[model samples]
Target: MIRKIRQYIEAQNLCLPETKIIVGLSGGADSVVLLYALQRLGYSCVAAHCDFHLRGEESFRDEQSACTFAASLQIPFLKTDFDTLGAAHQRAISIEMAARDLRYEWFEHIRQEQQADVIAVAHHRDDSIETMLLNLIRGTGIKGLGGIKPKNGRIIRPLLGVSKQEIMHFAQENALPFVTDSSNLQEDFTRNKIRLSLIPLLQSINPSIEESLVQTMAYLNEAGKIYDRHIQEAIPAVFDEESGRIHIPLLKTFPSPESILFELLKNYGFESERIGDIAHAIDSQSGKEFYSEHYRLVKDRDAFLLSVRTINHEPTTYLLSPTTREIQQPLKLRMRLEEITSDFQIKKENAVAYLDADILQFPFIVRKWKQGDKFVPFGMTHFKKLSDYFNDHKFSKPEKEDAWLLCSGNGDILWVIGHRTDNRYRITERTRRVCCLMMECG
Candidate 1:
């Protein structure tokens, strides 16, 4: 096992000698064998076990056994506990998915915390074949069909080229005792079902199904590298950034937009279905948008633009009711009452006024836009709907929601946030209060 592992390391060229290696130990046959094999090779390794408390006392036993194995080998052992069932409940996903999430997360946490250069998993040739078959059954892209890589970023699967049969033979020959997980015998999991039901049927035809599939994965892995190189080169051409937006012009070049969208999104770490939705708006007019966890895509001409939603806040209204008063939120309004020597008129845009001063109220409020809002413009006497104004201005749905509007307690729209105020609030010839309000709109 040590000899083959050394060969595997050399073939993959994982890293240099000063690099620290951390092994994920489950106390199962594969992981135990990996721990034993790694220790014999003397590659500066440590065993890290995650006790996903799903199997009750069995989970604790797994951790104990892993600790025992590391103790016997005089290697450092790291242990962690997690509630597998509770995580599933919180995520509202299946137990299998939750366990997978927790497992990888814990593995990465330990890898970083321990400063390990690579986190090794004990996935053998049979496991790789099963992964390929599973991906094929579920429908996957070139990367997924490439199966588990021997070295994926910080992960190194040294036993990926070795078969389960070889590991068992080596364990038996060395008098190694390893516990078997009963779940492997059960056909509930897709992988177990493939191993118990599908591989045998395939072997009936090829006799060397596992070997053939592993060779197939190797070929696909090479092909996938070439495909990935093209995708990486193609990204800058397709991705566009302007006015805080991202778009892909490649959709128009291809007759099948879906294929392009899927490949593009795969590069962006998004699901294919979401990419389909992004491409669906290609023919639609501008301002059409789709949202993801961290990014948003908006249609712009022939380009599919990606945007980061950011909030740029500004002061709402300027009130001139008081002689000398300042509004909070970095905004201040100036007001002064001066007798006019000659007759003159002030436009609504220049200053605010009202027909009467008896109706004016104090403690004026300023705020952003609200739903079901309507206000009269400075020039127009007719009330304009905020939604209609947003539509006319070609604001996206989220942008419309982000717009600000100034209103009064009496349900009067004083100012159309950051632009101008209603003519009803303009200073006129019969103005009793001569006031001015200043806003910090940026």
Candidate 2:
């Protein structure tokens, strides 16, 4: 088994000869065997154990046994205890998931502190089979079916090419001391239930079930590589990294729009079930939006805009006093009271607003545009709904979302910042004082 692990490691180029490795030693049969095998293979090994405190004294016993074994092998040992149940409750996750998260996170921390080149975990062929089955039951995509990778970032699984039976046999033959977790026999957990009942029944039908599944996983992994390459090539044309947005034209450029969208959005915390709805919404309306845990996807006129969901800023109204020359927050605007002269030239830029100061009330308010908001656009006689104005001007959903309105103290719209000004505040020839407002993005 050690020779086989050595060959697998060499073939995969998982680590260099002099590379320091940290093994996640749970003192279980699989992990114990992994630690001893890596040591026998002449690699610098450090043992790191996590006591999840799930099985009372059994958990402490496991930790003690792991430390003892590491000492016997004269290896550097590190261990940490976790309140598994409390963590599960806090994270709103299952006990199994919480424990897994805690252990892997600690292992990575140990790896970096120890200057270890790689962290080794004892995940064998059987574990990969179980993972594939679990993913299938949970409605996973192609990547899930690809099964566990031997090397993922700084973690390496040398035992992945071997079976659980082989690992046990090697442990027994080598007289390796290991502690068993009694919780493994319980049917309360989904993984344990699958291992205890489902796998045994499958093994009854075909004794080589694990081997067969391993081969299937290998094929899927290769296929996933090809799929990944295609996604990489399609990304350049379909995604704008600078703006963190995905171009919906990818639907027309790709054969499978839903599949492509799922791949693109999956990393952004979007679920598979929501991808279909988002794809359908892309063709329906420009203002349609969808949200995931961390991101929001807006269906614009020509593309889908993806952005991180930030804390929603409270609707704040900033008062621009007559003495105030500039206000920065919400939007940057420079205001000046200029005496109207024959040489006074109105700027062509929409960002610059020349309003009649005599008609304006003091302490103007700058706020976000709200529903039912109306404005008498410059050169227009009748008031138009702000929503209608946005549509008429061909503002995208994002553009409308970022729109702000400047109004007088009497609640009359003065300027739709960066767009249009109300004709009610427009400078007339008879106006003596002009409030020139120039907006600049910070």
Candidate 3:
């Protein structure tokens, strides 16, 4: 088993000979065997254990066994306790999921603190088979059917090529100290039910079901690589990263457009069903919008705009004095007082504003545009409603909401920052000094 583990590690290029590893030692049969095998294979190892405190004394017993085993091997040990049930309740997740999340999260923390090359967990062939079945039952995609990977970022599974039966046999042969969590016998959790009931039922029909599933997962893993490569090549054709827009027409040109969109939008929090719905309605759902937890997707006439959901907090008014050279809260702007010269040329860019300094009052007010707001646009004689200006310029809802205004102390609109400047404050021949404000784009 140790030789198999060494072969798997080398084949996967998991780590170097001198690579320091943080082993997730639960003192279970699988993890105990993993720690012993990795040590025997000549890798530097440190044992880290988590006491989730869900199984009461069983949790403490596991921790004690882990600490004792690490000590017997003269390996450094680290342990932490968690309120697993409380965490599950707080997160609104199952206890099994909460425990897994907390365990891996703490394992990464230990790895970073110890400066370990990788964090090793004892996920053997049986565990991968179980994971594949679980994901299939939960409606997973192609990636889920591939089962657990040998390496995931800094986390490595050295026992992925080893079987549970092999691990037990090796532990018994080596006289290893390990503890069994009695909870495994309970059919309470979904994973426990799968292991205890579903797998056994399958094995009863086909004696080599595990081997067949493992082989199927191996084939799926290779196929997933090809699928991912096609996805990588197709992404740039449909999605524009700069504008965060997925062009509907371009997306429709691809085969299996819904599946393509699913892969594209999944990272942005869009679910498979929602992505499929969007894809089906892409042509007819103009002006419709969909929202995920942290992102918003708007279907325009030609494309889908993906943007982060921002909080609609009350607009803050920042007062800028003459001495205030710059203000960064609402947006970044560099302010400078410049004297008009004979050869001075005004920049025609919309991002810059050249205001008559003497006409403007001190302590300028910077605030977002509000209802009934009007401004005399540059070179215009009459005041125009901000709404009319926005309509004429074809501003989107987000653009209008994000618009900022620069007002004089007496509340006279001077400039619509980054859009237009009031004609009343425009630089002219009579203007001796000018207030130059330039919006800095990130």
- Largest lDDT belongs to which candidate? 3
Q: What lDDT tens digits, residue by residue, belong to model 1 across residues 1-442? A: 6788888888889766666889988888888888887777767787988877777777877778888878988889988887889999999999889988898888888888988888888998898888989988986778888788888788889898788999999888887767777789889888999999999999999998787788888899898887777666565556543444334455466455565567866555566667777767777777677766666666755566565555446545444345435554433333334444366445444234322333446545555566677877767779888778766766665555545544554767776555667767765666664434444434
Q: Lowest summed lDDT over 10 consecutive residues: which window, candidate 1? A: 349-358
Task: Quantify how close model 3 is to the true structure by its C-alpha RMSD in Å.
Answer: 4.0
Give me the overall lDDT of model 1.
0.71
Among all windows of ten consecutive residues in candidate 3, which has the lowest summed lDDT?
A: 393-402
Candidate 2 local lDDT, residue 206: 98
- Segments of candidate 3 deviating more than 4 angstroms: 16-20, 42-44, 67-78, 83-98, 105-116, 169-177, 204-207, 236-243, 314-328, 332-344, 354-367, 370-394, 406-414, 422-437
- Sorted by lDDT (best first), the order is 3, 2, 1
* Candidate 2 per-residue C-alpha lDDT over 1-442 given as tens digits, one digit per residue, 9 for 90 to 100: 7889999999888888888999999999999999998999899999999988878889888988999999999999999989999999999998888999998999888888999989999998888888999898877788999888889999899998888889999999989999887878789878887899999999999998878888898899899988888777777778887786677776667777777788888989999889889878867767788999988888888888888887867657887877886888878998899898779898989789989999999788998888999989999999999999998998877778788888898999999999899998888778999999999965
TM-score of each: 0.72, 0.92, 0.80
lDDT of 3 by residue, 194-251 (tens): 9999999999999999999999998999999988888887888989988788888888
User: What is candidate 3's TM-score against the reference?
Assistant: 0.80
Model 3 has an lDDT value of 0.89
In model 1, which regions exceed 4 Å deviation?
56-68, 78-82, 90-93, 101-116, 226-244, 248-251, 254-260, 263-271, 285-388, 408-412, 419-442
